[model samples]
Target: MNRFAWLDAFLGRLIAEDMAVREVPEASGLAPARGISVGADDWGNFGKSARNWNCRWAGCWAEDLGDQLRVHACFEKDHGYLLAHTDLRRATPILSSHAPYFPAAARAERHLQDLYGIAFGDHPDPRPWIRHQAWKNGEYPLRLDFPLAGNPLPATPADQGYPFQHIQGSGVCEIPVGPVHAGIIEPGHFRFHAVGETVLLLEERLGYVHKGIEKLAETRDAHGLARLAARVSGDTTVAHTWAACMAMEKAAGIAVPERALALRAIMAERERIANHLGDIGGICNDVSFSFGFYQFNRLRELWQRTSATAFGHRLLMDRIVPGGVTTDLSETAARAQIDQISTFRPQLGRLMDILNTSPTVENRLIGTGVLAPQAAAAYGALGYVGRASGVDLDVRRDSPYAPYHTLKIPVPIEQAGDVAARVRVRAAEISASFAMLEQLIGGLVPGPVCAPWTPAPPDACGFGLVEGWRGETLAFVRFGTAGRIARYFPRDPSMINWPLLEVLIADNIVPDFPVCNKSVNGSYSGNDL
Candidate 1:
């Protein structure tokens, strides 16, 4: 199917129909996006048009200008991106919501309402999202006048009066899980309504770990923002840092060296492989398969140790700077990387084979936590979660950037949207990442690792899209006067994927929640921020 053909046809329709839309220069990036500015009144119509054209909603964010709030919506189809934005007056901060057209926009709109105090008119659920009594109802934290340190914490608990959905029926009881748990994990509250043992409905309450990441990004220099982006989600530090740098580099018109791009790909692939290994083991551990858990963790620990020796950090934090990577790869490190791949590849194959043939693991994983293809598409799920549900969307292949465009990247997909299917997808991706790493490392070009630093023009806008281990990761950067960061937004794939867990958990037994949750494994820290 020509997924993006409708984009051109839609533009033509806009021109012919004389809709209140105007084309504008795209935000700077490797690929030029179709940018359009829409009036606040026409925002919902714009989203409807895109939905009719079969466009997928990527993400939405709002930036607080001095007197107005600019809301941005991103859509993607067939490797193409269209950015549509609308501005609302600060005093009257109300605009039509896109939630009616795009279900994924609901949380994003609520997020804007919480931070920017922008009311989304006609929104289905207007409850506070990221604001768990951190601030008052009228005090917007993202505004320019708001203090960076923010208001003092209240003496009372923040989530005291929050409302959760209630189901009233015979034999239906609610089970409230934790904002804290016995095992080490991020904080989130999950409410499950079940009859007998089958889950009837599941509602999630997040934002316990909100650290004011977006508010802290304002006015930061290039290096400072880079450091902050790396911590947006520690597990995805390499990806987030790379994305922030890509946005800054594009805005400044600085081209990263070929060698640096290749090295970046190598590190990214390593990150993907390490995380997948850990996840595979975690899923098995949830099913009481301790052998798989211990073995996989053993491999992951060794993998991180090698990464530390090669890149000065186990998680590869601070490895990526504004222009390019922080340091160059040496001969010994490259050889060690290749050697590690060779050594672990066989062990992984053996373990996977044992898992595939084991009746116990197969019984626990297969047909568990099945997410329908329609539901997956509706939520715009990503990474292994979407791929397992047959949504063949990968930023590497769909919207290639830098070294990825030059390499042949294979995206593995599965039709079964179950725990087993997700595991299979991760194993396949690890294999694919191994192959890509070999290509990236073997074809190391001779050039500078980092590019020259130059200030971007004032008011310049740039977008960065990278397929992180979890899925399509996006970073948007706008520069103020003298190259100061006016606003920075990083959309982790978790933000979209976490909500789908609630939808997929229904009709399953409560005992299977652990494995099902692990199968989707949405990062609470990533989603909350």
Candidate 2:
């Protein structure tokens, strides 16, 4: 079907199904699609960007559907958003089930269930998503009435009796890892049931670091909300902050200065490079290559320190504000930095050669934890993971924004979805980002770095999507009267990528978990939010 025709048909389906639908002009994007409007609790009229022919609906209650929730389905271009809202008033109190239609929605639904005291009826696998053992069963912190101070007394732990399907055979053994680890990483439990060394089944139990970020955002103003967004993942601070600011400005009908937009892009690319370098080294370290690890790590540290010197923060936190950026790069500073990057290129090339030629490194990573193209698409994986699996979707290229439009982004892709493929993708991306940075610095123009923006009108909604280091980082913002935040939803790519880990780990030996994990490298804090 044609684009507009397909959208109309989709809208028709929603309206026919008794769902509320509205076409919002301000929040609308390119033609042939519609913007759906929804009420923001603190921020007034928040609208979502949709095809000119999209549908908008209100609160929904979940219903059980065996192993998954079959609550509500809203279609997008490549994937759909299925939501399950549990009715807390019911006596039997069955959670509304959904997310079977879209694997990406599974993590979000699980989070809703955990925070809102809602249940996903017949969810395929209903483990405690965001609920840590810190609170009691009767305590639902996300509810509008839930106190922010938290309960004084410790609540009994929720029933921990999840029935994991077990595999039994000769030479079979169970391997449990984490919830506590040797490193400083966040806590997550992974249970691998294996026959000899080969993994038969893998079960993941996360939520050890649920920070209630969403709940916190629900109470703050736009500025306060942006601060919280930046903390979603420390490494991706610049990307997340930019997304939140973009969403707020869009909702407020504010246009950012061209120079500010350029600066934002530069910061984002720098952040991306810093992370890619670290991860490339980290993946090598996982396979016991300390030389590559130390060298790449040193490079990453140098890059981060450069960013700190330029932006006043190593991760560039708070550099993005609604309608603009917080600082500008002087011509002299830009030139010096660009020259430094040029000098660092040869050293990076040498490290790359060392890693590429190592037989031991290549052997462990080449065919380990293969995620086929189809599985990658189904999981809605993004960034390096998706690229490695042949899903060539980059927000910067496909959905161009800001300086990215002026500077063409060449996304690197690979057919192999193994650890080695992930490493190669990161390496390629780092090179591309450095090239783009040089161009941006060369083209830097002296102008105002920020524009003044008034608060958004009551009941305005806006959505922002940025290509972060991990993947596509999405932020939905709604503004209420008096400039308060109405509702904020920041969806990290980790939320979608983490589940793919389970699928990819299958049939692979238990010993390769670290290598496979480093390839994906999902943030536990980001996902727990």
Candidate 3:
């Protein structure tokens, strides 16, 4: 279906199901499609949309009446039902069946259950998703009524009798790897049941870094909330900040200047290139390719230095604001930097050729951590992981937001679904992003970078989605009369992708864990938040 027509049909389906539909223009000047009003509560307004083709149209439901609980769904746009607030609260048997429809929804529902003490009656896997035994059965820390200061901390949940499915056979043995590891990475435990050299089953225990980011957002204004979003994951600061600001501008009906949109796109592409470069090197390092590792790491450092000089932060934190960008591009500096990238191109090409021909590297990565196309779909994986498995979905290309529509995005996909494929995808994406950067700089326009945004009216709701380096990042925000945030939900791609680690690790040997883990590379900090 064509874009506009498809949106109309989708909206018709929602309207038939009793949702109040509204066609709203792009408030942040990004020009997404229609926004439908889902409902409203004392906390603020609620809404939904299928703004981008690759994106799921999710329900943004919030309640500020007392507990200030915010609940939402991030299901596929074409294949899910919208459950009304009244229907959700009928005390009817909680339907646990939604997970089967959208696997991403499973993690989100579990998060709601943990923070709001709401029951997902029939939730297929209701096994205490994010509630890590810090609170009792009746306590919900996210509730507004819950004391913000000096709340008694509950004891950690006891580990005695906690159940994990075991795989058994004549030669099977279990190997456990950390909720704490040797690396500086965040905590998560992986259990592998292996028979000789092959793995029979894999299970993961996460949630070691949950900091109640959503709950904290309730107490901050837009700027404060932006800071919180930037901290969702250090590596994904630009993406998170952009999503937060997009939501804020939408809520306030603020239109950012065209120049600001261009600058945001430039930073986003740089972020993508930087991350891909680092990951490529890290993946090589895992496989003992010291030469490749050193070269790629050096390149990555160069890219980061460029970002630090251009954006004032190596990771570009706080570079995005509600009405546009926090900084403007320096044409003279950008031109000089483009020259550096041009010089680095041949070096990157030589390194790619060397890595592609390295037999040892190829042997380890070619058939490891394979995620079949169907399995990837069932898990709802995104970003490089999904692309490697043949999903072929990229939010920038499929959604065409901002500068992406003006400059068509090229999506690179592979069917291997293995470590090698992921590495290749990253390599190709880095090249593509560099090309995009060149084009963006060449077409640089001059104008105001930010538009002034007044505070949003009380009870206004907004939703924002950005194609982060990892995948699609989404934020739902609601504002109060006093210009403070009433409710906020930021859904990171890690939340959906992390669960797939368990599925993909099955049947692989314990020795291959490093390559497998690097292939998925789900962000623990992002998920825990």
Candidate 4:
């Protein structure tokens, strides 16, 4: 059956039940998705219906208008996306939560509660997710009246008093690990309940580095917003920026030049390759496999240097603008990148052989940090984390845009959900990215890189979804008067994937935590934003 056929059928079912639904005209522009508005009372029923049809929960974000608040929930099945949103009066902003149907909604809802002051009825984890008391009570920074500089408390209190879930039992030890770490990584606290070396439970408390990216995004022009999106997660700069630009383009009803779309895809593939290589190396280093560590990092270094030669920036930051890309790929640089990918394949294959055959490496990784397929699905895990556990979904293949709609993107999956499975998935993704780069560069089109910008109507909204290196990245944009950003929310894949770490860490020894953590490598900046 056709994907849209399924979407139509689903809509009919909703309408039959007297649910308020209207098609969004902007869906025909930048994405192959559908959008609808539901009554606030029907929002929970929408979640029930989506769960009944086994829809994958994409993400949810809240927007604050002057007198009301709007909450949106996104779901996917096959190649079709359904965006359901409802408005609530700010005076009484109470709504049913979707956490009961989608476990992934728990953290996002808590985040919405903290930032928007919207009350979610029957939310699973009611404790604040992003609020560490940076602002005083009754101050919701995302609201229009809240100052960008923020109303600072005369004296900010210490954040040492969060009530963590205590596990009490004979011989059960609690080990608290950081909001500050010995390593040079972002701040996050992890509390572990262990009996000897075996971990009984692991709970993570993050939001220590929240930069208020959402609050800062308001009123920025398209170009400024795109630059800000690039920094949402520096490692996934290309994908995040492209997603942001895609959303803005959709909002403005602009078409990017075909050649620019090709260049964008090429840059995105390069980003996926670079991150996977660095992570694969880091995972090996955690297991004391120095040979694999050095070899993979060397490959990553070469890959990035080649990117620098091909693109102006090694990380390709700010390469994606509102309607298209900043620069086009030259024939000479394209040939160099093709050669780089050709040379990388053999070395990667050799490394895979070493990992597959080495008993010592297998002992450390094969069964460590195993996440059940059921658990993966429950949380709506994305990218390799979900794919390794058999939750086979990829935004590129599922909701293709521009060049990806023309290319044959392959999604690799593994049944094992352990650290070894995660490493193998990353390796396979690098190979797939190489294949895409070849297709994108070899069939490079000729045209202008960017389109002429036309301002969107006031209060127009659009969505952007991209398959980032880590997983499905989502961006929501609403344009205000004069084409300024009214609201911008970029849902990094890490937001959904971070909670899975706690699920996978249980039953593993403390020593194996490094490899498990490296395998997932959830971005602090991405989620904290």
Candidate 5:
């Protein structure tokens, strides 16, 4: 059965009634998207489908073409993507908000309101999302004529006047944390409304680090753009770069060589392993599990060092090129990586055994931050967070790209929907990734590292979707004349997962917030953009 068979059947009825436009699910990207373009009147139907279908809400985005504003809301069903869009051409382009249907759509649409001036009708909360009242009204930054250097004004004053909702009660109190943090972390403000230690509401205020990445990308070539995307979030360098490169390659109609595809997959898996190692360690450290922290930290250091020795960068930065990967592994490095996997398996197993049986760790994790599967699906949660919550969708398996299509990728899934389950899922994924890397490296194919390609036609559009360590990542790339970027939008998985953090923290005490937050591990930089 087509798991999303309900969509086609329901949409067909709309088309028959002349209320909905014909769907072109197989017409969005180089590899056709299972999507449709609905009129403003029918946009509500898409929202209904999202609420009723139990679909994974992937992302929502907007494009400002000076003359018109187009909004695209994305969803994932089974192995394919579903895109729903509505266009507005009037003086003030506006449409019904879909955020009521998909909670995750709120931030995305609110962002467009700040950047493109596209208003949403009936949006539940119409607050400024990314724009912190810095730019004056009518100054839509993402529009074509906006100056590259930004508005000539004094440095933006501190945005401290944000209207955080007040919860007034006899014993209720509020705790406001950073847009500036004490540790080596990015800027994001968190507001916690609590009664004693119990948190009643959690508010996340991000976008303090917005670097105008989308605006800056308009002038870059493919190679230059890849460098920028790689830094979208330092921890997810490979994932963001690969997604951007895939869109560039697809737009230019270039096919990467089989060997290059395999190498890309291997490098991606390595990135996944590296991040999970650090996060698992961070989770332990938060709970004062010092022994577990050191053990995981040591393993992560060694793993990243091996990756640098082979890939030429510690975090594999800029390793993924537009058409393919940047370099090949040396024979010595290849053999070492394989051997390391062999030796590391048992070490990982022992550590996992200890963590699994440790009552202290279990007490803090189990049922602490429970994310029901329905909420995960609504939030469009991805990566470990989604898998732990029983929303078992892995882009590598569901939407296979290149080598993952050939290899057996066993996505680790757990339904506990808590910190411990997230930890277990990562442990399982590390083992699977280690073995998969060994197979890919041992069966190495001899071929060129990059693909031969042609320049893309002006205004050509393409999209890339890759499974990053955090979750399903996507990049939308459109080319101008002479291969310059017209528009580039990178949808880091953090955009969707970050809001879910607020939902997860509810009912948890203030002291346990650190462990719960670490479990989700949303990227502030990624979400800020």
Candidate 6:
């Protein structure tokens, strides 16, 4: 952090103008990682950088180490980023909120509040975001003392005490949907404020499916943790697992085999292809185009079936292990997979052309559910959603890691930021992912699939940032005294994009909300956890 004048000076300025500080070892470094901190009294003054929008705020999380709470802030430093942690030692758990500067921090802060019993001053929203009145007051579940089998209410009452915002104008009826939806999807509630047919606002109520992953992750060994990461969000299995593996490997300073790196890239691209196929189809189905849904569902099923043949799981779950990946390609299986992609690409191009030309599809997508580029950037939008809105920041290209370092990936950028633009981005990404997969599969090198294991030194730490199908997925890890996970935080892109969902759906009608929501497709389980 001290390397760059602007970023380093920002912290220097904090120490000079605000509070006395100390420097500790950083949890994870994207290479040359360091940490500096200011006292709790000066925390608010130092936060002025985020408040002034000097740099983009990546993520904020807390670790309760009995005597004190360790809060880490991850933010980008131009092309690279800096990781910093602030140690708060006090009689009471209280600190200033980062939500004032980064709106995305609001959810993370609320999450910390419910999980760790931390209090924040001037928190924009005081309502419970994760707890949902399930546990008794004064009981923080993630404070190391909470039992593994949680104390659940015998008869869970309806969460009628939540203070959802209301409107008082005539004809402005509210539609409350989900937490328990019709489909087999995860739970999340959506409240839409509408007048007649036009939507005035959309407030999201998530965290219904919070599985206490942070708490459970503490008990898992290295191999067990990798398996847990794979299940973080079932659809993002490959991305999440790779991120966890990369972080752990980095912490141990272990180099994965070249062949393993190439194989990991292959698995990631396959996951991307499958998810885009499903999302494109889902967006169409929401707009009453079931034909598109059927076409894509079939393609996705074929893709996953091939994945099962190649990696032994339809969704590629648990295939990415800690040191490397659990995969070795046979010529027969590799060739068949390549041929499947070759055949699928041309069909995808033709179908996309037909849908783009169709008046019904175009009308439902174009100029609808528009998210302004400025708003997108403000909310730290990632993946296709950010690209569609003219904010092109692809992790694979911008911040290259592993196989991506040796390959060229053209990030699809669209300026319209509407449903149609999202569709275009997905279609383009599907083509790009296919081409990348072709390169990875065709250029396989023979080597050991897994690297020899080395136990992390006490407090071993690293950061993993992978561009998942949905977007940039980040995971941080720090090992404990006995080589166990002391602190682990995975900030999903859905957390960043969900807040902006309110912005895009404002002018769109109630009926079109489904299509608009599908365009963003903020992961329910990913965001909830």
Clashes of each: 0, 32, 6, 1, 3, 0
Candidate 4 lDDT over 368-417, as tens digits, reads 99999999998889999999999888888877778898888888899989
Give the number of the best model, judged by TM-score. Answer: 1
The TM-score values for the models, in the order shown, are 0.97, 0.86, 0.88, 0.97, 0.96, 0.96
lDDT of each: 0.88, 0.72, 0.73, 0.88, 0.84, 0.83
As a whole number from 0 to 100, the lDDT of residue 246 in candidate 6 is: 86
* TM-score for candidate 2: 0.86
lDDT digits (tens) for residues 27-130 of candidate 1: 45524567788888878777878888778898999888777889999998776888888888988989888898888888888989998888888999999988
Clashing pairs in 6: none
Q: Residue 60 lDDT in model 2?
A: 27
| lDDT score for residue 437 of model 4 | 87
Q: Which residues of candidate 2, in runs, are more than 4 Å off?
A: 1-5, 12-75, 78-96, 152-163
lDDT (Cα, tens digit) per residue for candidate 2, span 1-529? 2423454565565556444554345333111223442221100111122222332121122222223332222233532222212113433334434354456656676776766655666566677666766676667666656676777455546436655567787787888788897676778888899887888888887887778787677648877887898898898898899989988887787888888988898899999998889888888888888888898999988888888878788889988887788888876668767987887788878888878788998898889999899888766678899999998878787667888888878999999998889888998898889898988887877789888878877767666778899988777666667888756767788877887899999899887888898889998888776
Candidate 3's C-alpha runs over 4 A off are 4-70, 77-87, 90-96, 154-161
Cα lDDT over the full model 1 = 0.88
Tens digit of per-residue lDDT, candidate 3, span 75-126 = 3443222222322342321323345445556666677676666666656677
CA lDDT of 159 in candidate 6? 72
Candidate 5 is scored at a TM of 0.96
Per-residue C-alpha lDDT of model 5 across residues 41-134, encoded as one tens digit per residue? 7776667665676666677777766677777777766666777778888476777887888888889888888888888887998988898856
Quote model 3's TM-score.
Answer: 0.88
Estimate the Cα RMSD of every predicted model relative to the unseen true structure: 1.5, 6.0, 4.6, 1.6, 1.8, 1.9
Compute the lDDT of residue 491 as modeled in candidate 3.
76
Clash count, predicted structure 2? 32
The positional error of residue 234 in candidate 6, measured at the CA in angstroms, is: 0.4
- Deviation of model 4 at 253, angstroms: 1.5
The parts of candidate 6 lying over 4 Å away from their true place are: 1-5, 19-34, 51-53
